[model samples]
Target: MVDVYWRIGMHGDQSTLRRRAETRGDWAPLAPGHLAPGWGDGHGDGRPYLEHMADVARAAEISGFVGGLMPSFPFTDDPFAAAASLVEETRTFRFMVAFQPGFVHPWGAARLSAALQQLSGGRLVYNVITGGGGPAQRWWGDEVEHDRRYARTAEFLDLLRRSWAPRPQSADGEFYRLADAYLPTDLADQPFPEIYFSGSSPAAIAAAGPFADYYLSWLEPHTALTEKFTAVRAASQALGRTPRFAVRIDIVSRDTEAEAWEVVRDGFSGVDLTALAEGRDGDSVGVARARSFIDGPVRDVRDLEVEPHVWGGFSLLRGGPSFGLVGSHEQVAERLNGLVDAGVDAFILAGVPHLEEAFRVGDFVLPRLTHHSPQGALS
Candidate 1:
């Protein structure tokens, strides 16, 4: 059974993929003399973004989506705070919070996670992101080097797991030291949140082996994914552990192929071809690999299609993952099923104006998927 999850975008989002008149975060009239909605002027800052997030979560839950991946980015709201705000959002919709382990100490993180897991009844999943070395890390005043970050993360997880022990646990590591450390009985008894680890470097794969419940990566070429997943599996096996695989991808689905293509075609015009495709220095092999799929983009957006149903035009309109599934509902579902067959057990999917798209995908794309149910649910 494959897990189908929607992306709960914490930052501002555009209504559509088009960038010419992009009204990120909120909505407004883009054209001269265009009539505005009656409710438009009434909302000064529009509604609180959390209200919008709840609407999306509710839609995703009712639509049969397993949950939503709450991403952590510099410009986004805190995933922990955002998830807490939606405690009453949906009954079973999980919050897969994407966060850099460096930002919080393992013990503190465990306590916060335990509180939410208790409140949400085990509806918490951790998307553990080691900071990609660049200005972003500097923005947070982080001084750790690229490879050492993963080492610290490995240590962090080691201590984090130890923190949940029924008896006090102690640890002395390069990055952390704990003496007779343990959670309170109530918090310690809370279910552990599954860790979905992401990274593409050698250090990353090594660090993920022992802790990752799901070895996660953004969507890459299928062959590339096969090789990477194989390495992660080997790493896990060496330690007598097994971990499932997941991919995060964007989606563009419509009733017909032409309709879907039309969206990208319109979005292609808004792309700044020069900046969107250029490769820059980064410590993350994953970020570099994601950008690598679009080999020598010249004119059209479809040129970035590394494979069928896979289009690398996402950065043209918004930030985040560049490659995504772009086709009719059947076509997108077919491609998703293909990934499942290739060993992917979960997918973190996103689209613009997350509120409406959650319903669109839940109604159209999700039903067509073959592995949408979990293994326990199967006869």
Candidate 2:
């Protein structure tokens, strides 16, 4: 069965206008001649950072999600630190902490992953991310070309695996070199965290086949996803390995299809076009593919229906993983199940306000889908 996971927000609150206004602060008034609604102007509930994170973590855990994905970004709190802090907040749900390859040395990453696995009682997973694009790469002082980034990532993963081996191991790769590196803390037979990797480029697929335990893709049409899965499967087969497949996407499910569309319209009503354009101007293959959906014939909010239930309205506001499934609960479930039929083994999903939507999906959609329990072995 496909295992389902939720995306945990490490930044500001993700509530809608009504919820934010009720719990946070009053909304700003719309000015004359403005086409968008006045939102995101409220003073939030003033919860401490840790307190908010704990609430989200507990909600997702109790809601039957297998895990939560904590992303690594220049702006958000450090994923490792946040995951470590959140370990005590939840019991069963795993934390897929995003770790960039070149940002830290492979030895350090292996050590950190081991420590986190111990600390969380084997509830840690690693989402290995190669730098996103030119701007984000520059921010991290990584000037390597696109393909070289994946090459470095391949070397990094190779070293990380060796570093976690029971005995001391060493590696001399193009981007990393280590001599007799070993973790001091005993893992006590605990396996290393599962490696979840994401990239759409050829270099990424080439690297992923050798190392990735789960290959992740942003939401795309069934045809596109089938092609990608075939490519990755073929690449991994060449190496005598078969990596599992996973997908990450947003969801806006409601009681009825019309209600879901209403929610989308309201959510994007206040979107800033300039900010959206800036986000779309990324060089990554994933970014380019997502932008293509919006750049096609469906160029306006009213035309975001890319498929029966899949919506590209979010692509106008966000960059990576911008597509979303929007419809009634049953409709959304059908779309997700279709992906599962097409070979997606896992789903990493999120909505605008994670806390509430975790419950919504857990109570409504999850029970309707054929999914594994949190502790069940993934297929």
lDDT of 1 by residue, 141-193 (tens): 78899899999999999999998766888888898887887888988999999
Clashes of each: 1, 0
Q: Which ten residues in a row have the lowest lDDT in candidate 2?
A: 17-26
- lDDT tens digits, residue span 89-174, model 2: 78998999997798888888888788888878899988988867777778888888889989999999888888876678877889
Off by over 4 Å in 2: 17-47, 272-276, 295-300, 317-320, 371-379
Error in Å for residue 237 of model 1: 1.1
Please list all clashing residue pairs in model 2, or write none if there are none. Answer: none
Worst 10 residues of 1 by lDDT: 30-39
C-alpha lDDT score of every prediction, in listed order: 0.82, 0.76
RMSD of each: 4.1, 5.9
